[model samples]
Target: MIIEIAAQGGFGGITAASLRKTIDVSDQPERMRQDLCDAFEPDQLARLASRPCTNCADRMTYRITVTEDRGTHSFTLREAQIPPEMLDLIDQM
Candidate 1:
């Protein structure tokens, strides 16, 4: 599986090309791979993305896309909606 993340709209409301990250779970260690898969399960990610969010100016928004053998899923969510663990995963990628 492959995951792509693009971050936008922070304090500066700007997103450069460098803000994009791509993670190839297949290349990670066995444990890391398992953690990633568990953290980014399609059903869970979709649930988080679909939730309602209140006004949050200057907070970052992230567009996360996951591609698997079956197909792909994409979600755009406010930073506050993302779990802390997932946020760390994005950063480490």
Candidate 2:
């Protein structure tokens, strides 16, 4: 399955409509949400959702909450204020 969560203006902010493309989300949004989750436990998803606010300054924050039989998990991300040293990497995105 391939799910594409697009951002308007080519970057920043995420909305329900932005996630309008869920081709085959067998285990999606969850799997493709970010690369960091790869190192964490499934239950950790919920903790990420409770992090600091990402929607600062009219920017719409995005958070993913997953609920399983045992419990739930989450993840969130706002505009990438990548450090100057990481500017090159941000440009690629």
Candidate 3:
């Protein structure tokens, strides 16, 4: 599977190259891969309950995309809405 993470709309509403990251699960270490697998299981990802924060100020919005045999899925979340596991993955990226 492939995962892409991008950050946009910060203080100046700009998205620099450094704010985008992508990774293929097959290239990661065993432990990292397992963590991704658990967080991306059909139910876990498909049912993520994050709600965009409309009142955010000077806060970046994150866009997450995952692609696999099933197709591609995307989610846009605010920092406060990101789940811990996904947050860790984002940090590593």
Q: What is the descending lDDT order?
A: 1, 3, 2
Runs of candidate 3 with Cα error greater than 4 angstroms are: 12-18, 41-43, 49-55
**Distance from true position, residue 11, model 1, in Å?**
3.1
- The list of candidate 1 runs beyond 4 A from truth reads 12-18
Candidate 2 residue lDDT tens string, 1-93: 232223322333433334322223344356343432332234443344345654355443444443435555544544342223222322332
TM-score between model 1 and native:
0.87
Root-mean-square deviation (CA) per prediction: 2.1, 7.9, 2.8
Estimate, for each residue in 1-93, the C-alpha lDDT of model 3 and write its tens digit. Answer: 898887776466555333888889999999999888777654565455354456676666777788889888887667666677777877886
Across 1-93, the per-residue lDDT of candidate 1 in tens digits comes to 999888777465565323788989999999889989988878889999888777756788888899999799999889888889988888878
Weakest 10 consecutive residues of candidate 2 by summed lDDT:
81-90
Best by lDDT: 1
Local error of candidate 3 at 64, Å? 0.7
lDDT for 89 in candidate 1 is 82
- Candidate 1 residue 27 Cα shift, in angstroms, is 0.5
lDDT of each: 0.84, 0.36, 0.73
